[model samples]
Target: MIKKITCNNGLRIISEDISHVRSVAVGIWVQAGSRYELPQENGLTHFIEHMLFKGTATRSAKQIAEEFDRIGGNINAFTSKENTCYYAKVLDHHAKHAVEILADMFFNSLFDPNEIEKERLVVLEEINMVEDTPDDIVHEYLWREMYENNPLGSPILGTEETLNSFTKEMILSYMERHYTPDNVVISVAGNIQEGFLEYIESLFGQYKSVKKPVKSLETPAIKPIYTENFRETEQAHICIAYPGLSINADNIYSLVVLNNILGGSMSSRLFQEIREDKGLAYSIYSYHSSYEDTGVVVVYGGTSSNQLNELKTSIFDSIENVMNKGFTETEILNSKEQLKGNLLLSLESTNARMSRNGKNELLYGKHRTLDEVSETIDEVTLESVVDLAKEIFSHKPAISIIMPKKVDL
Candidate 1:
């Protein structure tokens, strides 16, 4: 069962108590990410994620690491396109200490100039590493071409020019705007102790933001343009994307079902036909990324340059077949079962439960029980998925490809 409380200052705390487990997972989720950044602010959200672990007013970076190590707990953080999360998994006995350290990092991070310089170099190298990775960079190119001038298209890692320009004051100013109490959610799951909610409230509550929360972001317009990057890589990587539904769309379950039939699993059509049947590509898959106002469905495949044309042809043929034939009732039923199985299996992990509750509270301000979700997935029918497939495939896809410099398409 999930319980929720809203602090006086507007911070939200959500938790699910799993009595059988001996561990606890806690996550501090903030509604700040690359999409919220201005052109100049590009990667500031991710940068702040790195800075928070550098040190706090009372704890050195090494001490912070050692504290968790001493407790045999795990503490880490990640910045995504929509939000940032700092989380820890610890034995139930050590939950309080873990939460205390997380709160310290959250409220009292120094963002020291010297540490910023060091981390900036580290992030720059990280960017360089991605650049050298063709498969990874190809997806980055897809977003760039698909969203064009929108901040949604901006790389989460930011450009070297922008990264070097960030200042401590700039970081603080950005956080001030997006890190308001109302925009934060604390999610805890696993073997929660009695009074733990009160303890979290005491730590996170009472800090009022002087500024109003940031305004809703402008929706990005999709740009379906084709782009190619020629690189000295062994294979050609391609991504074909079409507009998709928002996170709250009524037909999201249908789209998920369609995506599963398309390329979401090893038994998926693209995987079977493209990789297994024709042996045209070793890696091929499709996925959907849904945001607040908009989303995208992307199909990606990598193959030898010589086989790139055949792989592309095969992918298009497979999608066309799906649009023309739709899916059988058996296919839809099996896909629904597969999705539900995956969902239920994932919930067995404390970390997964913590993340689900955090993201649900952060995004929807509501929670759905496992039964409710399973029912919804079951409600997805052949007609719904078929109709959604036609609607999605009707659009001209934005295409991104990275190929060997010597190869010509």
Candidate 2:
């Protein structure tokens, strides 16, 4: 079990003492991301995340990066649909340096106007880079059609137009409004000493308490719709998605198990039937993504141009069979075992644990261990998985297809 502590500013901290680990991970998390933005401010949160490392109160971006690497540490950050995280991993002896630097990056970033404009172009390039690749764009379309105008439906990297419109003032305001201590979490895992904790306390404990409480965010209404575009390409890529339960839903475990049976692994029904038996496509998989109040289950595949429609039909047929007939006892037993065995490899890194705990605390008010997660996965019976499949398939998932520019239907 990880130990939990609340800083003076109301920021929560979770720490785990792994008996003799050589490395440590420190992460800073805030309940701010694409889902937290207003329509006009859609991409500001992510923009601010980018600006954070450009410069802080006392360090330049290059210095921030180099100093960490100088100590044999690695650093990175990412913004998700529901949260933004900045983290560092280093030898256990360098824990103080990691937390101090992370604390500085978060609380004291300088939103330079010139830097903002430069980064604007940088992000624009990023958007362009993704558009240049079809695989990236198809996922965005799947989310858009599935969630429609809701925040959950929005892309974490934001759209080109929205990102271009982001300005320094917008980022500053967004950061001030959403990046509050009460909505933040700091997690450390490894060989941590009491002095390192004290140093962290000294660095972050002085942050001023946010004047406003974090009100619950309202998720957008479901927009069940289908969208299709004809693209000329040699290879056809497709993504089919449906509204699934959010993390807050009681049936989420069932959803996980249900996905395992659908296409989560090679032994999954979709992969075995679609790839091994029929040789319809080289790749086929189903996965689910969950946020605080929203979730989407998606099944994706790649096929020859002429087989796009056939591939689509095959997927729908497979889904319909699962929804109506459910999984066999063998499928359920194997999926459960596969899922449990996969859990151990997942916890090998402190960074993963840090990020995992930070987000869980923000959502569920506490952290759940791997054993607890496995138990929940095991407790998911075939009936429950079948029930979840029925409920999810009721929405009749939508599809997003990508293809080479030359192949015509």
Candidate 1 at residue 197, lDDT?
A: 82
The candidate maximizing TM-score is 1
Model 2 spans with C-alpha error above 4 angstroms: 209-216, 231-233, 405-409
Q: Taking the tens digit of each residue's C-alpha lDDT, what string does model 1 give over 284-369? A: 99999999999999999999988888888899999999989888999999999999999999989899999999999999989999
Q: What is candidate 2's lDDT per residue for 1-409, written digit by digit as tens?
A: 6888898788788888886778899888888888878887776777888898999879999999899989999998888877888888999888887788887888788888888889988888887777766666788887777777777777777777887787777876777677888888888888787688778777877777444644467775456566655554457788988888789888888887789889999888899888998889998999998877777888999888778778888998999899778889888888888888887777788877777777778888877778888888888898888888888888855777787543443
**CA lDDT, every model vs. true structure:** 0.93, 0.81
Weakest 10 consecutive residues of candidate 1 by summed lDDT? 215-224
Error of 1 at 235 (Å): 0.7
**What TM-score, to 2 decimals, does candidate 1 have?**
0.99
- Supply every candidate's count of residue pairs whose N, Cα or C atoms clash at under 3 angstroms: 0, 6
Q: How close is candidate 2 to the true structure, as a TM-score?
A: 0.95
Model 2 clashing residue pairs (backbone): 232-404, 232-405, 232-406, 233-404, 233-405, 233-407
